[model samples]
Structure formats: C-alpha cells, structure tokens
Target: MEAFRNAVRMVINRSSDDQQLDCVLMASVQKQLTEVADAVTSVWPLAALSDLERRECAKTSAVRRFPTRSIVYDDDRNSNEANAYFVLEGRCTCMQRLRVRKMTTNGRNRFALIRDHDGHGQSHNLDTQKNVQTVYVKMSDLRPGSVFGLGERRSGRVVIATADVKCLLVPLSFLSKHNGSNIWGRTVCSLDGTNPTIEQSFRKFVVENRWEEYKKSLANDLFRKRRP
Candidate 1:
C-alpha cells in the first residue's frame, strides 16, 4: 500500500497536458473515478468496471491506431502521458527475447524473468562468467478487451502491434490528479483481481517465476522523479 501511495505521489507530481484536445472530456472521467474509487483496487484487464465507469473511461480515452509490427513502448525509456490502455480493436504482440553476448569466463549464467502488465514475458540475464546463451520468454497476444500499462514501467520496452490495432488510452496524469482522495488507487487495485484467490495465484505465478525485476520496473517507473 505504501508503494502504491508513493506511486500515486510520483504521478501527481508530474505535469499534465490539459491543453491537449484529448483532455476535453477528462473532467467527466475525474468525476466518475472519484465516485467509485473506494470500491476498487486495480483495474481488471477484463470485465471488472461498471458500465458507467467503462463509459467514462471511453469518454476520457483516445482511440489510437498502430500498424502491424509497430512498437508500443520501450523498456526503461520514458513512456508517454498515457498510462493505461483498453484494446478496442486488433491485436498486440509483446515478445521478450533474450540476446546473450559471449563472454570469456567460466563463471555461471543467471537469468531473471519478468512478465509485464501487458502479458509479455521478460527475462533479464546476468552472467558471472563469460558465456553465451539465447533465451526466449513466452509470447503474449493481447486482443480486444485487454487492459494494460496502468501503473507499469513501459519505458524502453517494446510492445508491437501484431496487426492493425486500435486502443483507448487513459493518461496517467488523470489518475494522479485525483489520487489525493485515495479512491483512485483502490479502484486500480480492485480490478487486478476479482477475488483474493485469483489475485494470490497471479502473484504466486510472478514470484515463483522470479519476476521481481519486472515488478521493480513498475515500482521504479512509478516512483522515479520527473521534471515538471
């Protein structure tokens, strides 16, 4: 909870593009989130929000199209204003491929795997000895109704459009702007899982798979300092 709170603080501390044409409807979105913030935690990628909430999200979000094989976000690089997404049409493929450079040592090879919020599997390799090995993480196919990127580290990572894709994106600033009430964060967490069991299972999968690096990416992204 403290981590989440800190993330909210980081987001709130950033500047917003209120003058953008896309922000015209943000007022309505703010109001809706304010009304329902207490009842939720994480926003579920599937069907967790109410009709009204969904409608408001749609109102505030902008529809964007990307060509096939286009990069959505890069790992460790600063992401754009938008922090969340709801796929409206088409598909996205997030692939985490490993490139091992041969080193001249006899140590050992250690690897850490991270599955990102968009369902992409990521593996970070650390070698004590100079060795060369190619590792491939699982592939994630994101389709319509998939919600992702909220509160996650997206900078320097690559998310590509597998096909022509359309998505409704909600800017991170919107959530930060209303986080003072604390309801906004709750709403987000509430949707990550409908029940504790499911949430636990999801968490277990991440932990057992040693996705701590992936989790840190999100934490670092959310808490890092930014210039206004």
Candidate 2:
C-alpha cells in the first residue's frame, strides 16, 4: 500500500511540473508576439493616419508616379457646332451610304410621312416621328470626297462645318494632313481659289510639323461653354 501511494505521488508531481513548463512556454511565446507587434507598429505608423489623409496621400502618390499625356493641337481651326470631322480608317459601303444620305437629307426642307393603319381603323399623320439619323466621324478618317457645310471660321484658318450640308464646300486638305495615303500631304481648302500658295503652305506646314489640328478643334468644341 505504501509503494502504491509513492507511485501515485510521483505521477502527480510530474503532471504539475509539465503544467508549469507549458505555462512558461506560453508566456514566452506571448512576449515574443508582443515584441513583433510593437516593431511593426513603430515601422509603419498607418494606425495613426486618418482615412482622408490616407486617401489623399495615395492619390497624390498615384498622380506623381503616373503622369497624364497632354493632347497637342496642330491647327487652330474650330468646327462649327454642327459640323464633325471623322477620320476614314478604311473604305466601306456603309460609309458611302451614310455620306450620300447626309448630303441628300441636308438640302431637304421637309420629309414625307408614312403610317400604318389597323383593320377598320383610320390612319393618322406620323410626321412627328421623323427619322433623324446620327452620323459618327472619327478624326483619323477625314479624307477627300468627305464634305463639309458652312460654319464659322476659327484660329489657324480652320472652319467648322457639318458633314451633312448642301453648299459651301471645303477641301479635305484644308482640314487634315495625310500621313501616308493618297490623301497624305494634302489639306482641305476653300473651293474658291482665293490663295493657292496659302493652301500649299498650309499642307507643307502640317506635314512638316506632324501636328494634328482636328483633335484640338474637337477638344475645344467639347469643353466650350454654352452661351445662355
């Protein structure tokens, strides 16, 4: 019975010692973790920053690291509010149809109305639902045979005209420079032979300068304030 008591006492003492060792290990681990956290906090003071300040700082940094490219204008001409210049990237049947339609529609003062009637019902005039087509022209696609209508003239002798118009035609060469196509090295000019040398000079200037005037005109148009 004495031997049995001694064995039980030995087991109890070992268990207590193991528990003490576990506590010491746990305390050491906690201390190490606290030190790591303190080091991180010291190195990065992000915790002290306000949300707005952080956002602003991030924005400024982004702006500084990545600057935006400024658009340059070759000519100073502005298109009229209604006129648009589009670049002809490639030839297509749809483009031809659109150009023809625009020209035809521009001269028309009024259009005919068509309406469908139900059985045993009377048809009414549908003139209010006039089909007005919107045309999109890109800056790179303006070429000879591209037409312009009358508008105000601006700086750089550039005139703005609607692509859809009846009279007052301007040559494609006067408005844009040809990079390396049949239209290259040309400028749109007034059909009225006012100044041949000026037209030639303008083309030469645009080609030599590698400047793009139409883009500037577009930018100016887009940002221009509307008069009340």
Candidate 3:
C-alpha cells in the first residue's frame, strides 16, 4: 500500500510546472483515496494510479476504448443498465433535447385567443406546450477530467465521441456503493460553466480586451429598440 502511494507521489513529482493544474488535480484525488484503503483511486481517467489500485479497480470496472462517433448514452431513457464513464482520452459531445417556453407579444394589449389555454379564455397567454428545442453541449471537448455517467444523470444527455476516445467505464452499482468516497461530484460538479480552459484562454482574453466595444454595441442596440 505504501509503495503504491509512493508511486502516485513519484508521478506527481515528475510532472513539469506547465502541468501544474494536472498535478493539483492528481494530488487532490490521491488525498481523497487515502480515506478508503480498498476503494478505487479517485484519479481522473487520464491520471496515473498505482498498478495495484488500477488492477483492483479493473476487476470490477473497465478501461474501454471507443471509436469516433460512438454513442455513450441516450437522452430521456431509463438508465437501468448504464455505465458511468470517465474520459481518459479523446473528445465527445453531449446532445440534449430541451423544451423551451417564452411569452411573446405582438405590440397589442388584447389577450390573444391563440394564447393561454388554462380555461381563462385570455388572449394574452399562448399555449406553448409543444415548444421543444435541442441543445448540444460538448463534454468540455472530451476533456480528460470530465465525468458523465448514468449515476450522474448522463442518461438524460446523449454523449457521442467526437474523436477516437478511451474511457474508464465503471458500473453504476459499484459507484453507488462507494458514493461516499467518490470525488466525482466534488471535482466535476464545481465547474462554473464559464471561463474557457487554458487552451481556449486567448479567445476569452480577446473578448475581455474588447469589452468596451461590446458594451457600446449592446447599448446602441438597446437604444435603437427603445426609439419610437
């Protein structure tokens, strides 16, 4: 056990400074794994785990390889036998069919009969029960650290490999049993859905630098809308 822990530490030490983020992520995972000796290591799919831990985990889990465009999950389906996947390599996109509803006006005051159907006979409200929309969200470009699985509600999101991909697949039942030691929620759930990664930082930087121009354009558009 000590040897395995040392091995993990060695890998962290060998990482270059440029890999600081990866190092931190690895260390954090290791720390969480220490709480449960027999539990599978909490390393991300791409991170290194001790040979012993890896082997033990594989006895119940699998490191599967997938071709490009493979479907990982389907939307709105019961995930009775679904597996949770941790991306070790390649990229995938999550597709979801969403229903959207919005109240719209045609610059008139009388309630439109084609609108609210709540038996109020009101004309201002419109029945929007059939407004369905589709949304496609890439899984952080198949980022190595992302976790999407049946247990994590991936059953409602369709995941498709955008590139040749490899992932660690674990049974949802096993994950549920060890849910206490699982850092999957803490690590992946904390992302704020904003701010690009380092590779995409330049785009965000450019946008920030041109904030004034964006503000002016927005203000001009709002002013135009308010004009008679």
Per-model TM-score on C-alpha atoms: 0.40, 0.21, 0.44
Candidate 1 accuracy as lDDT: 0.53
Position 21, candidate 1: lDDT: 38
Q: Which parts of model 3 are misplaced by more than 4 Å?
A: 1-53, 101-139, 153-155, 176-182, 191-228
Off by over 4 Å in 1: 1-59, 76-80, 97-99, 104-136, 153-156, 175-228
Model 2 Cα lDDT, one tens digit per residue, 39-121: 22232222244555333333322110111221111132233333222221212111110110112344332322122343657
Off by over 4 Å in 2: 45-228
lDDT of 3 by residue, 190-216 (tens): 543432333233333334435755787
lDDT of 1 at 67: 85
Candidate 1 residue 172 C-alpha distance from true site, Å:
2.6
Q: Pick the candidate with the highest TM-score.
A: 3
**Between 1 and 3, whose TM-score is larger?**
3
Alpha carbon lDDT of each predicted model: 0.53, 0.33, 0.54
Worst 10 residues of 2 by lDDT: 92-101
Per-residue error (Å), model 1, residue 195: 18
Candidate 1 structure quality by residue, lDDT tens digits, 64-135? 678887876555453545566666778886544444343333443243332223345554344432454434
Steric clash pairs (candidate 3): 111-123, 111-124, 112-123, 112-124, 115-125, 115-126, 116-125, 116-126
